[model samples]
Target: MFDLICLGHAALDRVYSIAAFPPEPTKLRATQAMEVGGGMAATAAVAAARLGGRVAFWGRVGDDAAGAAVRDGLVAEGIDVRGLRTCQGAVTSTSAVIVDAAGERMIVTHLGEGLDDDPAGLPWPMLAQARAVLVDVRWPAGSLALLRAARAAGVPGVLDVEMMAGAALAELLDATDHAVFSRPGLAEFAPGLPEPDGLAKARAAGAAVPGVTQGEHGYLWLDPAGRARRQPAFAVRAVDTTGAGDAFHGAYALGVARGLEVADCARQGAGAAALKCTRPGTRAGLPDGAALSAFLAERAAAV
Candidate 1:
């Protein structure tokens, strides 16, 4: 049985680092450039696999060089790609990531049409073997369908609710056991509500756990008892924040699968994300089992 199954988008990313945003109609040369495996669910899968969890990734990719790169990257990371399919005529999904020196990024994505196609034909039996399922908002139909199946199979379903329309957001949350939102997603979902209040409101809507990630400030969560807790972010020299959240989600899923308390799970996630930010690229900087254990051990010793 797999520790986690990630069902959503996967793509190849070309990241360019510049000093600042370019001026109107002006072009700026990048200070550095790199290519890596990216996409919300895909990155999280890499994170889990690197952290010692048995992981499976279910997504579609075009039968192109880019798609092959993505597949090869995931397999190299030790993620099971047996559930992944190759679309014959479709173009592979791709992303152009522009990162400023401030560790901020702006992504221009081309989610090829093939990625949105229904994933009903995927290996449901394999998916059912997962301890938990992590999904992203990028593939709404497939994500929801997988969540429903997971629910029926009594597996925990986690929804990484990034910025999406209200209707879609509501539907996604309705199917999610745990709803983890980005800062922008929380603002969009609960217009004027503050973090704690918004989290409470989100829980009232049927989510077992509702949380929002506030970059360096850390994360805030509301438990089943209506109690709220905040975990402080670990101090680190953040070189790139691209896949920080994805790392957090993957670690959090592993924690939950191990039956850790919600608060402890969030702390573990924060630690993983902080470690991820200390380097560059999405998967490039991820910590392995011994590294993560040492990091957490050092934190405990300091405490």
Candidate 2:
């Protein structure tokens, strides 16, 4: 049985390191470059696997080299990829990520075309073996379908609210037990509202836990008791921040599977996110179980 199942987007990322984003649309020199697997749920699956959770990735990819890279990358990270479907003739999603000296990154993505969006053929029975399910906004149909099924199966569903239309957000929120929004996603959900107020809106819509990931600043959430809580980000010299949020969500889902309290789970997430920032690239920066444990232990000792 898998400890967590990640369902949604997956892609290959071509990353470049540069001193800064060019102010003008002009030629610039890259300090470094590499290719790696990315996408929200896909990276999260890698994070959970690195943290020693039995994780599985469920999503669709094209039958192409990019798709193969996505599959092989996850497999190398010890994630189960049996559910990663290959759609014939479709092009797998891909992204160009450029990271600057401060570790901030700008990404341009091509979602690709001719891909199947239907979740009907997905293995619904697998919910029985999963302790928790994580979904992203990239695939509304698949995310909603899996979220509903996970809810019915009594498996926790964590929504990576990266970005979505208002209607889709509302529908997914109702079925989501834990709705963790990206900074932009929270603003889109509750425009002009404060973080606490925005998350409150998510709570009103039936999400038991509504949170946002604040890079460097850390995580903020409304707990089950209606109390607003915070998990300050661990101090790290960031080399890249590309997949930090994904790492947080993955670790948080694993914590939920382990029956941790919401606050503790956020700490787990924060630790993972901090560690992820210490290196370049997406999956390359993820910390393993031992690393995460040691990081958390040191933090505890300092406290």
Candidate 3:
């Protein structure tokens, strides 16, 4: 059985290292540049694989060089990509990311054109073999399909609620078992509400666990019992913030599949994200199982 199945969004990210973002539309020199695979569920799949989860990626790309690179990168990371389809005449998703000296980044993305939105062709039978499934807002139709099926199968469905319209976010919130939102996502979903209140609203909507990932601050969530819980962020010098959130979501999903307690799962996610921030790229920065165990062990020892 697969430990986790990640669906939606896969892209080739072109990263440029610079001193800082310009105040105006002026050209600036990049200190370094590289290309790597990125995307919400895709990166999470890589992270889960690195952390020793038997993972599969289900998404679409184009029949182009960028798409090939994205596919090859995941395959190299040992994630099952049989479900990663390539669409004819479609442009693969691509992003231009500019990271500054402080490791913060600004991204401009082309979400691709001509990619299929129908979920009918997806391998539905595979859900029964998956311990859990993780999906992102980038592909709402597909995510909804998977989330509903996972719900019926009694498999945990983790939703990465990033930036999206309130209506779409609302529909997804009701379908997920674990709804983890980015700061902006929470703000959008429950506008003007405090974090706890926003999460409470999410829980009421249908998710058993409603949580938000606050970079450097930590993870806060309402557990199955409707009690609020928190997991402090692990402190580490950040080399690059890219993919850190992906690492958190991936590790958390893997933890769920392994039947870890909610708090322990949060800790696993925090440690993984912290470790990822210590390195320079996206996938290359994800911690393996051994490294994550050591990091979490050290922290526990210190505590």
Best of the two (1, 2) by lDDT:
2
| Model 1, residue pairs in steric clash | none
Candidate 2 overall lDDT versus native: 0.92
lDDT of 2 at 213: 95
Ranking by lDDT: 2, 3, 1
lDDT of 3 by residue, 1-303 (tens): 899999999999999989988889999999999999999999999999999999999999999999999999999988888889899999999999888888898888899999988888888888889999999999898999999999999999999988863366778888999998999999988889999999999888888899999999999999777788999999998878998999999999999999999899899999999999887777778999999999999999999
Off by over 4 Å in 3: none
TM-score of each prediction? 0.95, 0.98, 0.98
Q: Please, what are the lDDT tens digits per residue for candidate 2 over residues 1-303? A: 999999999999999999988888998889999999999999999999999999989998999999999999998888888788899999999999999999999999998778898888887777899999999988888999999999888999999998654468889999999999999999989999998999999999989999999887889999778899999999999999999999999999999988899988899999999999999998788999999999999999999
- Model 3 gets an lDDT of 0.92
lDDT per residue as tens, model 1, 131-189: 99999988787888888888888888888878764466677777888888889988988
Clashes of each: 0, 0, 0
Candidate 3's TM-score: 0.98
